[model samples]
Target: MPKLIEMMKPWQWMLYIFFWALFVTSIDRHDLATWPQFFVKFLSRIVQYTLSIIPSLYLIDYLRPIFKRDNPINVSMKILLLFAITSAVSATLVMLVMINTGWLVYERKAFVLNVLFNIVITVGFTLVFMLYFIRRYRELIALKQSFEHKLTAQNDLIKARIAPHFFFNTVNSLVSLIESNPPKAADLLQHVSALFRATFDGAREISFEEEVELCEHYLAIESSRLGDKLVVNWNLPDDDVMYDMVITALTLQSVLEKMLLNVVEMTTETIFIDITIEWHQHRVTITVTVQLPSKTLMIVHDLRRHVNFYIQAERLRAYFDQSADIQSDVTNEQIVTVINYPLYDVSI
Candidate 1:
């Protein structure tokens, strides 16, 4: 009994008390002019109603699981039938008790009328409870579906960040480096291994500095392949701030990887890339500016269509519970991508 009561939600308790109060206050006791008479009649009605409701409440609770497993039509019909039978029995018993105790007039017409009123009130209460349960069930289902969708989006974002294309390109670059510069190739392989290990480390978030270090390793591998052609200029926040702030793992790395792939594939000549990360007012903003040749404008457009920028944007939004304004701006000279999201700490 204690466990069952503990399982009842606050709303359920409130509803029960509300109906009890409604039923008690609704009893017609105006004919009892004296205060003592009114008090006795009211107390009598309260006891009668409370005793009558216990069996109905227990029956309804016992049958709830069965009703929930059936169709809505079946459930509604069963509940109505249960209430009708219980109300008829309870009203008959109450009418008999009232007449025997001289509380109600011993008249056939009056007894029938009282019974009918009781049935109506009981059925109304049952219908309200049923509606509340149904609405609560639907809300629970919607919340579950929403939670599932968020999990799916997070998984997709993580998968996109650690995509096969990046690894394939890194492997091809590693092969080339192995033949030309074995020592550099060894270092690149170690970075690649560490990056893959980090992805499977079961951590959903990492410090800002750790993410930047991962990006630097990625850039190092890319630089080995495109040596003189790739020029990267990094502007990062001060060490005190960078080491404290936390973000979704691989968020910046994913953006950088996409930008690098676009630039490396389109431009053959030397291209400059500037990465700027700033922190202000509890926000982190990463801006990547890539200098592209005039001839590669068409290629950049085609690459943009294939990238999963929207997925990354959604991931950030889910993590921060706010808009992660991820935008790309293209011009005749360069392509700039900006990502802005709320800064969280390790405790979060």
Candidate 2:
């Protein structure tokens, strides 16, 4: 139960009493003689008041399970069907009681009028409850989403931090080259410094074309050290496509870095990384193919070390109201990572 509902407790009971008074007043059609009027109305309404309790329990019992259960309602078909049947029976009994107890005399027309009255009351109550519950449900959803967003932001921060740390470590590795290989090292250092600056200051998301340019810069730096060992194949669409969708900063860099770390590199042996981008209908897909190492191939485990991967996934799920999935598909002897996102009209 929510705090607002608890606060409404006194008011709910007051409404119950008010309705009873109204129901009695409708039947009496005249001013009561003091105590007699009050007592008669109260006692006559016992069955009607009793009618409220069962339906209230039924409603709460039905809705309460929505929070706890994850499976489809049809999975509990028997129970739900039973509940619906029981509710209808209870409603019929309440009507019969109201008719028999002289709360409302049952002329065929009067009975129809009372039924309509009951329906109006039921609908009014339902709408009131729906308004309150929907607001609370939406709040719960927002809180969950906000928690996930904060979690993802934290993970991205950690990943962003790791990127700098990785660059500096590589730069430190190249320091020995500067001392020993003079001119060769200076050229390498300049390229590394330039690429590092570009990466550090780049926007979160860039066009597919811009992303390819960034990738080129990245590969240039990597090639400087691991020459003749890295190859890239870009199969891109030539349509008037726009990478207008929002993406995290250095997301491709992160994915590529993860790929590079796992694959073995040697001067004589080469590794091929295939990147392809295309749009189908309302979705744009960026697919990367990398040859996995023979021993073990799990990028998620590595990612979990610094940035909370599960938390990040939850955040993405919250953001789009959809899931971001990573699956290793071995098709035509290639392992692929497909990142798919929706394409929106830039005009909008």
Q: Please give the TM-score that candidate 1 achieves against the real structure.
A: 0.54
Error of 2 at 218 (Å): 2.7
- Tens digit per residue, CA lDDT, model 2, 93-184: 66577668765455777555544554455445545655766588688878876765675565556457547756775686478677887786
Instruction: Identify the leading candidate in terms of lDDT.
Output: 1
Provide the lDDT at 151 for model 2: 57
Which sections of candidate 1 miss by over 4 Å? Answer: 1-149, 152-162, 201-203, 295-308, 344-348
lDDT per residue (tens digit) for residues 153-260 in model 1: 666657665667777889899888889989988999988887877666543667888888888887887787777888889998788778787777777777777767
The 10 consecutive residues of candidate 2 with the worst lDDT sum are 303-312
TM-score (all chains, Cα) for each model: 0.54, 0.47
lDDT of 2 at 228: 66
How many clashing pairs does model 1 include? 0
